[model samples]
Target: MNKLTKSVLALAATTLSFGVFADVEREFSETYNFSSNGTVRVENINGNIKLEGWDRDQIQLEYTASADDKDDLERIEVEIDASSSHFSVDVEFKKKSSWFGGWNGSSGEVEFRLKVPHEVVLKMIDSVNGNVAISDVYGDIKAETVNGKVKIENAGSDVSVDTVNGDVKIVMQQFKGDQRIKSESVNGDIEVYLPENEGFRLDAETLNGDLSNDFGIEVEEGKYVGADMEGRYKSGNARLLFDTVNGDIEVRKD
Candidate 1:
């Protein structure tokens, strides 16, 4: 064989080898009968989780799992438990055993997209390494993450959000009931937007950050290197509390 031909064959083999071990993905989807006042919970480890409220009286769940190796993809498991009043989705990773009798690290990613009734309550939407987003929901919401952002838009009831390493943003269309709304972050900003005519008591503070408001409430400087805002906006029974350790807090009128 000629040298050029041998070099071409070598290059082709390398390319084929790469193609054999590329990332693999799998998709899963399901629909369930759910009530408008049901509760939904989702937990993820390494990808985004997005939930949107719809007019339908059911819940639709779709997720995609991807990994660099097919074996790793197989090790990732998704668990879903559902009923008429509640639904929960969880992602669990099965440990792989190494030749040395120890656990080998398996890596995979899962992105979940869910749609449910507009009046359902989001009890817990937690993620360890991905973002959590919800929109157009009319019930109470509670979401937290260890290393991702938490964002909610068009929320019609009370909300509570917490994050360790990302921002928290909540935009409410209407503040329902006298329930308290709270948001906290350890290393990212917190921003909340409410209707201009809504009445709420605001108590926002940050340890090493600044506070800004559009409701004409005064922001007081902390003793050290922080700021806080405490007062009532239109003097209502609703209460809002926001705090952060290393980021800014902004309260704006929608």
Candidate 2:
């Protein structure tokens, strides 16, 4: 065979190898020193984001990337911006920033697991195609995602969450001096659980679903062409407002 024919055969073999190993996976983990009131923010364009607060003074982060194309795993950049009391994380790829939720199944995916200080703050965590979950945290938190679920449990302070095509669930341990909580979604449910004795101003609405109040409060219907409810829980001063387009909304006690 000629040299040109041999080169073509070699190219075919290389292509076949890449196809066979398309599902490449990569893992990364790191730890950084952090303190109270510190912030950890993430701008992820794919997969899930999970964060938990601990008592330690350091922050731990672990991420995994999987893709059908090997280069898709290799092209992801986890950029960190840190300061004395805050840290920022940005995940980058070749696609547009709005591609965070509009990618097809053939694209690569990334999942993040973070351990932050129990008293640290969490800024807006933006994502498109993955779920966002946080538990045992004690500060202000703002998270938004599209086409995924958002769950915040055992919150120690205020929280604001927004999502599209997913559910929003939050459990508050205590209220902090009129702290405001807001959650909104386009195609999912919004569930809030609060303490028994805390006073809360409840404002909730759903377009295509019902509002259930297990807190002994009444929800009036036909408020705005759908289910809507507003009331004062007890004698407290905190506020909570939530709305959804195609799912149920519930407020209950802990």
User: RMSD in angstroms, all models?
Assistant: 11.1, 10.1
Model 2 poorest ten-residue lDDT run: 1-10
lDDT of 1 at 230: 95
Summarize candidate 1's per-residue lDDT along 55-95 as a digit string, tens digits: 99899988878777778877777777787888888888788
What is the overall TM-score of model 2 with all chains considered together? 0.84
What would the per-residue lDDT of candidate 2 be over residues 62-181, giving only the tens digit for each residue? 777666666555555567676557777777765423466765433577788999999888887778889999998888899999989999988777889999989998888888888889
* Clash tally for model 2: 1
Please identify model 2 stretches exceeding 4 Å from their true place: 1-22, 95-106
User: Looking at candidate 1, what is the lDDT of residue 124?
Assistant: 95
- The lDDT of each candidate is 0.85, 0.79
TM-score of each: 0.89, 0.84
Candidate 1 Cα outliers beyond 4 Å, as residue runs: 1-21
Instruction: For model 2, state the Cα shift of residue 53 in Å.
Output: 0.7
